[model samples]
Target: MRADPTRASSADASETDPSGDDRAHDAAVPIARSLEAILMVADEPQSLVSLATAVGAPTAAVRQAIESLVADFDGADGGTRRGFELREVGGGWRFYVREEFDPVVRDFVLTQNPTKLSQAALETLAVIAYKQPITRSSIAQIRAVNVDSVVRTLLGRGLVTESSTDSETGAITYETTELLLTHLGINSLDELPLISPLLSDGRGGFDDVA
Candidate 1:
């Protein structure tokens, strides 16, 4: 009477594969849905690696998912083309208001009462507008208050958006959007009033106002 070595080996292998069941469960998630969930809240374009990591999918699968999303949004799948488009910019993927729909979206955002921003959002937007590439921590420091929610509000309103991420600090730097300028009836940041004169002491400028 002898024990089966093959059965014992199979048991050992199964014991070592801690993630085998988890991986199978994760595979049940549709790649497109996973990508959509992550991209919806993503403030900036996500690289393939980042998207893959966030979705727990392989890079090739993520790339395919992005392509599928592009086609789906473009009406290639027999659906109406979306008002927004998924674009690859600066080596990453993000959603943008389609060029033809920008005016409509802008009008809706600026004129729609439901979209009105709060005082905190306005203040955070102003800081981003003047600073032109300030991080959340820096904005919080200038305002002397937590700006996380306010910044999210500005982003939701399309007044401010992430411009870049700090390589060393991994902080997201934000800036005013063209939609903000359109709402303000201005062509450029230069058209905004100078903060230096607005300060009573004119010593610390924006920091003093905040």
Candidate 2:
């Protein structure tokens, strides 16, 4: 037998709300956590459009949620220390360690035994630091040897970084890192201790320091 029209009307009436505000609220916590994880794993800064699509939300809403997360991390709720933080740089959002804890983190990471550097690597770094924005071929010309391995090792260690690529020749250029400044205990490149006096011997030849 078919159900009665009257019964169907009763069921509809029971389900209806006059105010029409009974839609269940969606929790933002899970979405926020996913956003955090994405930023944390990214090797570099992430963009708003990319993150919004990743979290399945509108860009504006994602931006607000990211700001909220930043506030939460900066707050002192007294739990486990946060492993990473959300930061804005170069007009993009990035995850980085909190500045206050960087020293501790560096100390922990640097405790490992030293790795050896070849004479070529040492010379290549010196040339780049003193005459930066230099190309790999220039370095090779100066050292009179192939600088490929030296350049590769420097890039891997973060002691050197690419400055730009020459448009005409498509040559990649390298420069010293800020880490080099800190390592050398100097305020800036201009403060690098002078070796010019030693190089300026009367006939442009100096005694070897052996």
Candidate 3:
């Protein structure tokens, strides 16, 4: 018996069509893994468009991935809810420690790791303590080097915090925390050494050093 030509043509079409098995397989691969990996190290929340561009996925696909992650973290898939959650904030997405676990995380961070600050961190902290509500650029100018990592370390240690952002320049201004005072055993910044006595220029303490 001869094979039917129409059936043979149908089989050929199925094999040749770009929308056949290959596309289905690609669709089955979840984009959540890509999104998760990017979110893990992101210091700030990323917008959907930004996330899509980073992962080289379509915006709709990224959105769907975010939804899937949210569901999984919420235990909607019959699994234990995660201690942390992906959250959308300020028009972007980031992971946050779930409110119920905040105390545990905070305590662990405070008690478990009491490592000493580096010399760079001490100098950055001193600058922030004296010149507070100062921009990172100004701090860098005073230090005559990049202070990014040291400033981040101070922030991580809870010794410095963002006081405010400049309205015109959009620069973040940092200030020392009460925790710094507690560590220094001082009541106020006035307890710090006088700048004039330390400077050869007598008018510019930090600038002279810089």
Candidate 4:
């Protein structure tokens, strides 16, 4: 009997291989494109499992494609200025603005608020923004003043939040809120306006003048 090539091919195609190499390849095409779409549409970083399920591909394969896409972006020249980067934050993967180009990027996107922050409010906010999830006592110690009023003002302005309470000490830990990022016109706290002098100010006394 002569061997039938077409029948063999059909049989091979129909067979369910435990190994998903072939499926991974076929899935990768749409998956790769879908990953881009998801990242573009997402408000924040998404997880590997989320991307895989969203693109209907295996998590491993989607991760591989994501790495490839990131490599391609890094290799491209315009990409650096565009300031697009892929990063993992809060235990999930997401797209982020590259740190090197934030100034120019913010100029185009963020509008300045005419409202000015008082020295005390600015001081408290700075502490919360930098050493976030920090206790009120810690902030008070740094500011060298009672921060109850400052904390209340920040909370009222929607820029900071009492993130947690210490189980043992019962102290309230404050941190910058999502509203803070939005108000600052940035995507994350990591992109907060960098004041080199403020960062270097060991005494924690710095001006927030525009």
Candidate 5:
């Protein structure tokens, strides 16, 4: 027997794949599609490392997938440009509504949602009112609850507005809008009543509204 083919083939296969990483990568969902699914529901911009780990792909592959998504959303590959785009801001990727659609979206939200805010919304709003330029994460930490939907409700009602996303972290800060002042019939935030007296522990961290 001249050098058994079975042993030779086994040796070659072992040499080619010393680790099972390739199989795992191949088994994962397509990188681009998986990334899209995650970014769609992501509240904050996702960094390359985080996204790569999340999708079980190599960083190089994830970067390539991100580029492909950016082009696809921008219609650079001969398709209609989407109403939203994948943007890299604060050193991470996130989706943003096209600026031109703002007015239409705003009008629709205002008209469609007329019922008064639920108690949760009111509490969330109070936190933002006093902690101007606060991030959603901070709000949730303070209230000890998730406030994602409540923040969206405030944004839709035009009672809360966002500041520029943090340049390094991609964190979006929120503050009460003029509409909030109008709703309260207050000329300025300073005019709001002090809530320190109402605190059980008499904490000073709370401002005139929080």
Candidate 6:
């Protein structure tokens, strides 16, 4: 009996497309939940292209998802408004604490987390350590959260110091102190892992840099 070409092609297609069924399943959940997860830990605003690349979605879909998220966070759909929000700055999207909640959040960080470094302080310190001589505003831009209180904490702890102030902008730049190196148990910033590799994009096009 001769082999049937039609049946042979069908079997080959199935073998090559074994996971075609899973594509829909994987894509179904990534737009909202995955974006939220990414934004939660993000250190800076992410552009639409970057976000789409991370979530494996088209830019259009990502835009729609962003709009939906904005509305959701704003309580437009009759849900409890979130204390934080997704905001666009420097041509990217990032999360920020609502203005009204800043005082309370700062108080909690200073009072409740007195013994240990709050996450905000740690993040700000890392920024200064890697991007030394960075302004407070620059640090805030990278973190997409206000760094004023966190900078004060690092200053009080002696982990970071004001290195210089911009002559043109008058923005004070910060640098890591010896105390921070001692705590880190490293000789220099070079010992710190490459910042690009740790970032989500691996290259973190940080030209705007706050």
TM-score of each: 0.60, 0.48, 0.61, 0.44, 0.78, 0.48
Q: All models: lDDT?
A: 0.78, 0.70, 0.79, 0.71, 0.85, 0.77
Question: Which has the better lDDT: candidate 2, or candidate 3?
Answer: 3
Q: Global lDDT for candidate 2?
A: 0.70
**Considering every candidate listed, which one attains the maximal lDDT?**
5
lDDT of 5 at 16: 88
Task: Please report the candidate that would top TM-score against the real structure.
Answer: 5
Specify the poorest-scoring 10-residue window by lDDT in model 3. 201-210
TM-score computed on alpha carbons, candidate 5: 0.78
Measured on C-alpha atoms, candidate 4 has an lDDT of 0.71
Per-residue lDDT of candidate 5, residues 7-82 (tens digit): 9999999998746766644544388899999999998779999999998888988987888788888999588899
Winner of 4 and 5 under TM-score: 5
| Tens-place lDDT digits, model 1, residues 1-210 | 798999999899888765865664455348877888788877656888999998787898788778878888899957999888898875788887798986677567656647567788887787788876888888888788998878867765777877887776655689988888899999998889877777676644275432
List residue ranges in candidate 2 displaced over 4 A.
1-26, 76-83, 117-210
How many residue pairs clash in each candidate at the backbone level? 0, 0, 0, 0, 0, 0
Query: Which sections of candidate 5 miss by over 4 Å?
Result: 1-29, 166-170, 204-210
Residue 147 C-alpha lDDT in model 3: 90
Model 4 misplaced regions, further than 4 Å:
1-26, 76-82, 111-210
The lDDT of model 3 is 0.79
RMSD of each: 7.4, 10.3, 5.9, 12.8, 5.8, 15.1
Task: Please write out the lDDT profile of model 4 over residues 45-161, one tens digit for every residue.
Answer: 577887888888787888888876777667664554345877765445667668786566545433443356689898789878877788878787878898787676676565786
Better of 1 and 6 by lDDT: 1
Sort by lDDT, top down from the best: 5, 3, 1, 6, 4, 2
Using TM-score, rank the candidates from best to worst: 5, 3, 1, 2, 6, 4
